[model samples]
Target: MKRKRVVCGFGLGLLLLGTGYVSAQSPNIVIIYADDLGYGEVKALNPERCKLETPAIDSLARDGMVFTDGHSSSAVCTPSRYSMLTGRYSWRSKLQKGVLNPWGENLLNPERITMPELVRTKGYLTAAIGKWHLGWDWQKRDGSYVFDEPVRGGPVDHGYDYYFGPDVPDFPPFAWIENDRLTAMPTENSKPDPRGGRGGPLVPGWDPEAMLSTMAGKAADYFDERASDKNPFFLYFGLTSPHTPIVPSKAWQGKSGMGAYCDFVLETDHTVGQVLQALEKSGLDQNTLVFFSSDNGCSSGPSKSIKLAKELGHYTSGKLRGHKGSNFEGGTRVPFIVRWPGVVPAGSVCDQMVCQIDYMATVADVLGIEMPASAGVDSISFLPLLKEPQAAPPRETLILHNYYGEFALRDGPYKLILAPGNGQGFGGGPSDAEAIQRGDPMVQLYNLGDDVAETTNLANIHPERVQLMTEKLVSSVARGRTTPGKPLRNDAEIDLYKKHLHKGK
Candidate 1:
């Protein structure tokens, strides 16, 4: 694809000068967030272990910088998405545990400034397309949806100018939503899913396999429509693939010999290719800053297990310890790739600690905007690292959480889990009791520099480190913000040692 320069608008030029960073123009930002994609699933990230081929993702990595150490805020979807948009850890919100239930209230506080809202200050058009699991304020009465009314507190209400896609692929109201209303009211109850998805009102003849294709087509259309627009745009292209209802389209059925899961992964790669191709076709690829990452790690849904993929010599979590809902490395650690033509070094790799919460600050820094003190309180801009790959790490510490409110703090290479065991809600290793029975320590610690797999526990060996991290974790929660500013109050009083105390550890 040939590079095309976008002339900087006068307003953007002034903004650039104000922030002391000069650029030709503000680049179009596209975040391609995948659901339940593991760290090693990308062939380029784990060539020796990952069995499946992901040409589109691999090509993306080759065209940009790949971060070997990247993570989501949580090991679950809803919380991760929440943190990604707001730049605040989800634990600070009322939802300190698992995901929001179907027809649940919006997770984002209306007062909060989201990624889209932050970027729009500089006149950027924003659209959020596909799989908004963060939650919605559905109009409901008498224990059912009021389909005629527009959903409130959705993507549009927060920051996006437009929104589309099924709210949750495996959950309720199986139909298409455009903006804040369903394109077609779901008048029929969905058939019992063979893959064990929740039964809910669905559009007539709703085909689960077609969701990804539809999302990709809509995204392509969006790029085409906005190609001639003067303003730079931001698109949050969330994918529902490889998460649930493991229904690969007929064309991709057997493309991967590694069965349904692998096939779905390939289909996901194809969708990514479609989006990139669309960008290229629109001649916007050159000026677009593209990000590719997952909400969490690989999960074993009703369709197939990560174990089956492992049986075929494809380690979804790479060499990490646990899967989707765990606090272990496998759960939150994910494949992160950033591609910004002419700016970021191509085919380069940066092994620095970064979290999804940094998106807000990073975008702010890129656009030369100072973030509000109240918003993106946990975000630390990695813009320096993006400009210079070997720059010192933007953040020295990171906090990780799982579905069950389990906490893990990472300072430098050493990680300290507040509780024993993996703290996984699905297919995890020993439970707290099991770990106790197995003579495990009260807390778990590992030096990731020497043991990325988290094979041996070092809590006993590093008592001072454990105590220091524990205090830091508690202080972080108490302070309610990681980055320096006025100490904010948490929405709820968080008990960091709840799990440990419950298990008498």
Candidate 2:
């Protein structure tokens, strides 16, 4: 593919070039974010050990640049999503622990600029289609949700011109939501699933099995509508498959003989193919920049089914340690592929560190716009890497957090985990309580360059290094933003080593 260089100058505060300037040649951007997908789940990322096939995702790797050291900002869903959109750590927000509750208040502050909102300044039409795990302000009466009125503070309010998908696939009001209103008010309550997930008001005869296909179809329809439009579009296609309530349609049930989770993985790949096919069908493939990644690592199903899958020969996290909700490489390290014809070199691989939070700044660079000082404070543009795969890495250090709010600092190859055990999720590591009782070291350190699996703890061997990294982590949290800028205030007080502070030190 021929390289197309985009030339533009940058200045501070919201498209400083001019208020009327719009890039006539800006490429359409599509971000396909998978839910709970592990690093090795994609066949191309771990061909030797991975059991399942992901042709659509693999094609993205073959067509563009694949980052071996890519990661989500957090080891869980909501925080990672927040960071991806806002270019700031979720820990800086009030949500320090788990995800947003169903029908909870919007986690995004109204004053903050989102990816969609930023792109709108460049005259791009933005749409968020698929699982929006972010909160919604559902009208409630006496603690119960009332769906008669439109919900507030959703994708539309956060910069998206169009929005569709369930607030959460497994959460209440199990029906389709377009823009701010439910497609059909739930007239009945859903029964509890035998697998897991809470039951709540549901649309009558809503088929969980068909959910993935419906989202794909909607995305394809969206592409068809925007194909001929003059202005470029930004589509955040967040997939809901391969997560909880793991339901693979009947056609894909036995496609992967491993199990339901594997089957769902296959179906998720097909969903990617559907979106790609739609883009191609609409004649937008050559001009669209597409990103494919996951929110976090694979979930260890109930009864250690993922462990059983590993025993049977499917290494979800590949050679990495821990699973979802851990500070280990496996939990946050994810499959990241970017495809942009005439820009990103095909079949190129980069081993430099990159995080999802950098998306906001990268998009800003691509559109030839400079973000305000307050926005994308943690984001460093990787646009140079996309243009020149051999360019020096834009980021050298990163802060990783798990579902439990445990902090981990990564500087070069050395990783410092403040907490002892493998933080939450299903990796079967020692729990905080168990580690405390066993008198395990409070701090865990590993050189990823030497210990990708994180099997050996080097904290005792290198106390000085641990102290240095710990101080760096503290400074990062205290300063609010990671990148160079005016220090901002965190929405909540941040204690880097909350529970295991005294024990570890």
Candidate 3:
């Protein structure tokens, strides 16, 4: 049955009413988006692992709702973040494959209304801090390493009142940016090496082993000082530790027996703790909602897991087949934990399937804000689950887009992959049509509820379902563009990505 649409969203009120919430105040929201951490990386989600003790994250799940079936909109970084903020599908734009480079041109358009903008309208201060994978316009020309134009169309432009960090690297332009201006200029600065390795082009800066910790500390300070009667703020504190280059700070070095990758994650968890602490310190605990999730599954190269398994006896994506850059379960399904002090139940777990794309609508639903018709076209609000532990949200299908532009639509237990190849390409170019043709990209169907690892193929067993899924996948393509917030046509840049893709890690 279609849920009755109310003129005024009584959703949040009804949700609070379940617990007899009589307060007139709304909870402050904080979304902690982590880069490249997998579901198994969180100890609370994957308890069998002992090396990566995410005490901060474990406490997060212990105090909130741990959603088992949460997913990024795409199986990659840029697109997923785009969808999460815009509440729309990444395919709504044109550049569907891979992600943006550190110095790439601006991806989001000026007219886009972001989550921060939405919440700020209701009197909340907003900021975005961390790894900005979404494209920002930086000055680069004809193979020039130095920059010309200051980067544009980033967090500040997209509704974040204050922004820190870069479109890429920590190193020349390595200095942080407060809003559109530079926080500190990089002059007479040591030419830091490209920070990310394994999966990287290695931009400069990679300096100050204390970068991650400092960001966390400052963010905690920001929350503590700014979150008061004068400023109820929303902070999108994105962390970049576990992404690549495998640089764990000295304190965390060799801390996790699993390897440098796991150690980096420990710091990531610690950073999450700092944000929560900021809330608690400000006495905003009971009136705040904190969300923790990743851009996608771990951005591990195929060899990293094998090496870790041989040396430390560990698998990054747990038992899920395939890893980052592929259209497999491990590439997308990630850890999602939500904690709203006094509102969300502690020690609870939800297995309902939800995508990061739904974030905008859920927040809007929670705050009694309505989304503009053009935004979040693919979003379904899961606000109901926050109030009632067992109350179910609408059963909605989720679509996962791969670098190759091959698509998969997941409905309930059944998933249909619309491609011509094996859908797993190691080249990082994209599991595109050519790769699929070369690899027998046959249509695949799997019941993920029963086969969470996506090991068995049930396509042949259910031909009718395969046909239905194929139709849906085709429709998604027909309706697809690029991310909605992106510019109309950046053929010059999109083509550049397409040309350089074959040379990727």
lDDT for 95 (candidate 3)? 61
What does candidate 2 score on TM?
0.93
Q: 1-505, model 2: which lDDT tens digit per residue?
A: 1222232222223232332222346789999999988887889988878888899998898888898899999988999999999999999999997789877788999999999999999788999999998898777789878787888989999999999998788888899999999999899997787655678899998888988889999989899989867568999999987888888899998888777888889999999999999999999888788999999887766324456455777788888887788888888999998998766777878778999999998888878777999999899888777756667789889999987888899999999998878653345477766666678788899999998999899999999999999989888898889998889999999877767423421
* Model 1 deviation from native, Cα RMSD in Å: 3.9
Better of 1 and 3 by TM-score: 1
Tens-place lDDT digits, model 1, residues 260-331: 778999999999999999999999998898989999988856425556655677788888888788889988
RMSD of each: 3.9, 4.3, 6.2
Winner by lDDT between candidate 3 and candidate 2: 2
Q: Can you tell me which runs of candidate 1 are displaced by over 4 Å?
A: 1-22, 301-306, 424-427, 500-505
Shift in Å, residue 318, candidate 1: 0.9
On a 0 to 100 scale, what is the lDDT of residue 283 in model 1?
A: 92
Q: What digit string (tens of lDDT, one per residue) describes model 3 on residues 1-505? A: 0111112222343345332232367667788888888877777776664346788888888877888788888888888888899876776665667787546666776677778888887788888887777766665577654333455677888888877764444323565666776654444434334444323232244454666886787687777677544467788888876776567789888787666677788888887887778778878777777888998877667227657756765666776766666677877888898887666767777778888888887887777776676566677778767666456644457888776656778978888766543234641323545544455335667898889777667877888988887666555444433223333322222221123323212
Q: Count the backbone clashes (under 3 Å) in each candidate.
A: 0, 0, 15
Residue clash pairs of candidate 1: none
Model 1 residue 196 CA deviation in Å = 3.9
lDDT of 1: 0.85
TM-score of each prediction? 0.95, 0.93, 0.84
